[model samples]
Target: MSRRPHQIAILGTGYVGLGTAALLAHLGHHVTGIDVDVCKIEQLQRAEIPIYEPGLEKLLLSNTSQLTWTTDFSAVQQADTIFICVGTPPSADGTPDLQFLQTAVASLAPYLGRKQQIIVNKSTVPIGTGDLVVRLLEDLAPEFDASVHYVVSNPEFLREGSALEDSLYPDRIVLGGLDTALDHMISVYAPLIEQSFTPPASAPRPERYTRPAVVRTTLQSAEMIKYAANAFLALKVSFANEIAGLCEHVGADIEEVTTGIGLDSRIGHRFLQAGLGWGGSCFGKDTQGLISAGREHAYAMPILQAAIDVNARQRQMVINKLLRHLRTMKGKRIGVLGMAFKPNTDDLRDAPAYTLIQRLAELGAVVTAHDPVAMARAEREWSHLKYSSAVNAAQVFQRADAVIIATEWDEYRQLDWEALVATMRRPLIIDSRNLLRHPLTAQVEQVGRELKGTIGAAL
Candidate 1:
């Protein structure tokens, strides 16, 4: 295995791409991030990350000398390992769209130097995408030494908020490609292999037990593993929501029920916190892609499809809860506590809060929403609704007839519930995440207020 430092280029400097570039550079590799957005490149060049990731900026600033962000494709010519981290948006029929992946392959063709470079698909793509990308590269650069270009399916498993941690200490790193390239790719991750350095910056470092082994599987299996992991997590949330609904009817507290079930080692609670639903970039898209992949292979992935269907209903369930309270949303003023899907990041791509806010507006409710980072994105997506910071937006709740705890941000959890409720016209609080059910929920109920849980009716 060669120990030579590789020149790596990460295409698409979004969350996955930027995190990958930062972590790789921190491991002492030469990394250049490329994207068509020059303004983003300019921001990154100045050591400013365009997005809000917890520890990403620190790593980006620390590795600026080795990490470069640019709009030029010339960088592609010098890269020993180029990761295609561009988006593979879902098609109208819910299948994975390969247009961006294909476009990236075409763009890299003209710059195929004689050097053998591993062109890795770091993007979350469908199974057999490795073969498709490899074929596309060959057709596009037939005149060049096509044999030098190798395609690998190295899917990213980073979450939006904690991408850095997940990258550094990934539960497992699944590298998929031709058998010939496996050893070389393993050598590239030697720092992690030898335990010389830590995992990516996104995952939480273990406090006691030994680290989980990084599994190397076949490309198709590796691709399937990514989808399967996300699908299961989504399923867990949907399952929790389904149980929460059952708990409401049976007079069982979901918090206590989830805690009891979570105590079991196998079902060790992580995504079991029942909320409006799972809403992020991965779960929805990957589950659909997996179902599409199953159809392509003439297999039925009914279980995964049910998880997707359950998640969709979970979001609507929150709207229904809100409707049950006000009876008619017409002329109602609704205040949303959190707007981003999950707190800490400003990514509002598929946040459930948006769905609830939209539904409220459609039903003639005047909605005012607040989120720490996602306000700009939400403003763009839902132009009609009012966006305010948690501080100033206190007025929205002050005059609001009802308040919906949509995102369950830590900031929202720490809010002075008594004071905040004092501002509201009706002082009604809906704990969509059961976030306040503990000491806070008990405290609020003692204050003679009408509070509702995701599944339970208002008190």
Candidate 2:
């Protein structure tokens, strides 16, 4: 059943928020994007994407008239559905800080009228956070009492580069809140619910994936679902890396091993890419958040905990591999290719490159890093680190000991192999991602030096 267009406000114009906002507008809803950064808002107002997301800028432009950008929280007062897409980053103690969510709710407290509005939690938050946000808002706003303020946990599973596409045609749409408002949500997303909505022109047309049924459950279950999904993915990735390590010891090809196991249909083969362990905004934080939550319930999640531990050790494995090849990291000028977690964006919040960079630099190595997009953020994060354009970055490897492939980007794979060997003092390379192939490997070995990779051994 097609319904009247709704007013939707997305808080935080970061990758998740902007992508959500643009996709909603494309779905024929009136979207007002609010952000604290005036510069970002201004850029969005002109149909410019503040961050790098594939095909996002064009979508923003197409939906410009329907999408309004602002830095005001008062816009929430008029919103029929308010999606809290702010960041809930984990602190050092492995707990998610609710500062951003608290601030967003408090700022919009005064303007929330008696009229009922659906408050949606669209960020990746700790389990039971939906209830906490509701309690906080109710406690903060006394005067503006509403009979119905349904707090729904609608956690986003958006990958950075493909966020917009994921938003429009999601694998699932889990809504957790009062069953009373289930009708409203179904009505609100009826277009997608019916599969009658058109995707943003800029994005790739989604293959007709089975339309996900809206699972209505208690808010707690929905919150748990998000953490579970991410934790399981992290676990799978770590498991694959562990297998990759074993493959190295036993002279087995991880790629073939994964392929054979993946074809079983029981494993399904996603997130099984044996490379540097998983790192990004989601896996590390979500795992830690789950572990913290487990402690509150007097349960020990050893399996999950070990998964996190193994991921951390994977970084050390890379470092150890580099150490084995060169024997010493000191005085070596290392070129780190790809700094962002998964590439196509500049988000370095929990990027594995952070750990790799600091550890290498601490070992008395001068690091020269290059990312197709994230070098600027890397520079800001690591002030002492140096940046290089793609063309000249290989120069850092000149007279340098080892080059570590940290992030796998398309451009990084197509480097001039001969030139790289020619420029480097020692043409040694550590392929952390196993991104290089036979031709490149043979070339590197031709120069009386061998390139070592993680899939197994000193090939």
Candidate 3:
């Protein structure tokens, strides 16, 4: 059944909100991207995207006829569905601080009852928050209770670099609400659920991708799903790192071991990277939040606690490697290639590169780093450090004692490594991500590569 286009209001213009707005508008919905940040709103209005998400600018700019950017809360009055996409940063105790979510809901309460609409929580909030939202909204505006508007929990599963692609063909569209509100929610995502809409020119549908499954469950379950999923992924990476540590002593290669085990159907190869550990906004925050939430019930999660511990140790391991190569680094110049947590993004939230660089600088090492897109953001954060930010990767190796491959950017993979190594004072590389191509003539120390085998000698 074909339904008329819904007026969707996405609150907060962060990565999740912006990606959702672009995807919804492309799927024939009239989307209003709202935010409290005046500068962000003005930037969007001026055809400028504050963040670096691939295909987002092209999608929004191409489909400008169906999108609106504003700072007005009154836009909710016409919205058939309102999404709260605010950030819920982690507090000191590792629990999610929901101050942003609370404020967004408070501002949205008065605007209800213009018509019956579905208020969806797309933010990654704590479990049972759906019930809390209902009660809070009832207290704020008693007139607009469950009868006037329905509250739904729809947690986001979008990744940072691949947000648009993930939203377009999600693994699953989880809807957590009562029966009355679910039909409306289904209608809003029918194009995606049924795989009916033609693919965008920039983001094409995969060759063998089937229709995405719609998971119907209770509100609390949906919230739990998001946290559990992220935690599991973090555990997987940590597990690989732990095993890699053992592999080093047992004279086994981690890359070959992971490749052999990943061939099993039950253990498909995905997050088995034994690099400088996982980073960005989701993994650590979500894992720690789940562990903290468990503590509230007087429960202990030793597995999760260990996962977090292993991750921190990974960053420290970089320093251990540095000391092994450059003994007594009271005065040494170290070059770092790739600063962003991962490739295809400029997000530096809890990035391993930041942690590694900080440790290197504290040990009296003169640090110089290079990243394709993250230099400007990193400069603002690391201005106090005695460091130089290089525009290109080659400039970083000038008179440097050693270079660390912190991030696995594609541009770094295709670099003329032989040429770059000639400029460095010490032709040594700590390829943490295992990214450098083979057929090397320089000394390279990878995370899991056997210690005895010389990668063609002479650093």
Candidate 4:
């Protein structure tokens, strides 16, 4: 945290690593990014970003003077602060596989102790990973003086689509480890903690944005905070979906119910919109990781498991609605709108749309899907699902048997639904995201409403 600008090295170039590099560079820190992907590093070297994230390219390109990308580990020795941003993908049992983390740290070990270093863990890891990293550093680099290096956990809470905005203006920043290690990170995030940096025009600060607080804790507690926050958000979405199912049975409007409850100060209107269940890198992995931790302690995490169950069934809600109307999926040409897990990201990891598409294909339905950003990645990754792909939104609507709104993109909401329905073979619209405020003459089938009420309809 030198005021005159300090050199920092980031060990991964994924969303979190690259975004942190850009954010830090914006604050006048020189950042060097190291990664194993040859193509990705080459892209960065040419001022290109491999992934599709809004404003990330602009931010990185604009601050070229402060950034560097390389595949060399020797470059890390020049920086006093190094951040481990490698991936921790889940294993079969939901425990985070630390293979990538181990490799990065091992490569990093041989070069440490050359200077006074503050090594920060920015990867989403299991609760006790800090201690494990500390052990690895000592064991792998026994020749280096351990006193010159310090390990700390500084977890990131960046959401994919709005990562730039979220990082620029976050709610809080957590730094966990020994008290001695706390000051170094606190100083590192001083600009963000104080909200003193000049805002980027592309992502100006919101009028009501709050300054971030730097929360200090032990290593495991800091790690747990990352998991707990994502788990609770996942639970909230599932809770709303759970209630949406109940609303259909009780003849209540879900939007009305959610709005009513959201007015309460305690229950703010953030993740309460009833639609498809949660999907992304964080929620499922973190929740399952927490449950796996529970298993280690011999305590069954009934609530989290229930949240997961409720979320899984939400996919069925769309299927059940299709069955209720079409009676069978055999030979039907179903057009699905929106395929990404959510909008503004190409990441299809655990997307709710894929599960629905797979189910439709299994029942012998001819499916064609469209998304604003995720279509290319989806075409490459989801070819086995055997569904047709559409880049033009109108192609999805043309001669389609039915349309299911999967990913809530703003452009999907602005389509002329009345005109588009006329082109479809059957004008059935399954509004999964609670999109389309206007009704479609009883032909459009919206989820969580008008689906069930009396036992006669249930039967």
Indicate which candidate wins on TM-score.
3
Better of 1 and 4 by TM-score: 4
lDDT, candidates in the order shown:
0.76, 0.78, 0.87, 0.87
CA deviation > 4 Å runs, candidate 3 = 381-386, 451-459
Relative to the unseen true structure, what is the C-alpha lDDT of residue 129 in candidate 1, on a scale of 0 to 100? 84
In model 1, the number of clashes is 13
Query: Model 3, residue 331: displacement in angstroms?
Result: 1.6
The residue pairs found clashing in candidate 4 are none
Candidate 2, residue 275: Cα displacement in angstroms equals 1.1
Please tell me which model should have the higher lDDT, number 1 or number 3: 3
Model 1 C-alpha lDDT per residue in residues 1-459, reported as the tens digit of each score: 456677898889888888888878877789989998888899888877888888888778877788878888879888888889898888999998889888888887778788788888888888888888777877887545556667778888788787776777667778887765676677777665554665444444656535536677778888888888888898898888788777777777677778899999999989987767888788999999989988988999998888888788877776776666679889988888787778778887788887887788788888777787777666677676543445444655778888888876777666666666667777666767766733322223211112344522222
Off by over 4 Å in 4: 142-144, 450-459
Ranking by TM-score: 3, 4, 2, 1
Q: On residues 139-250, what C-alpha lDDT tens digit does candidate 3 reach at each position?
A: 8864586765888988888888888889998999998989778788998998888888878888899999998889888999999999999999999999999998888788
Give the local distance difference test score of model 4: 0.87
Q: Where is the poorest 10-residue window by lDDT in model 3?
A: 450-459
Clashing pairs in 3: none
lDDT of 4 by residue, 240-265 (tens): 89998998888888888889999999
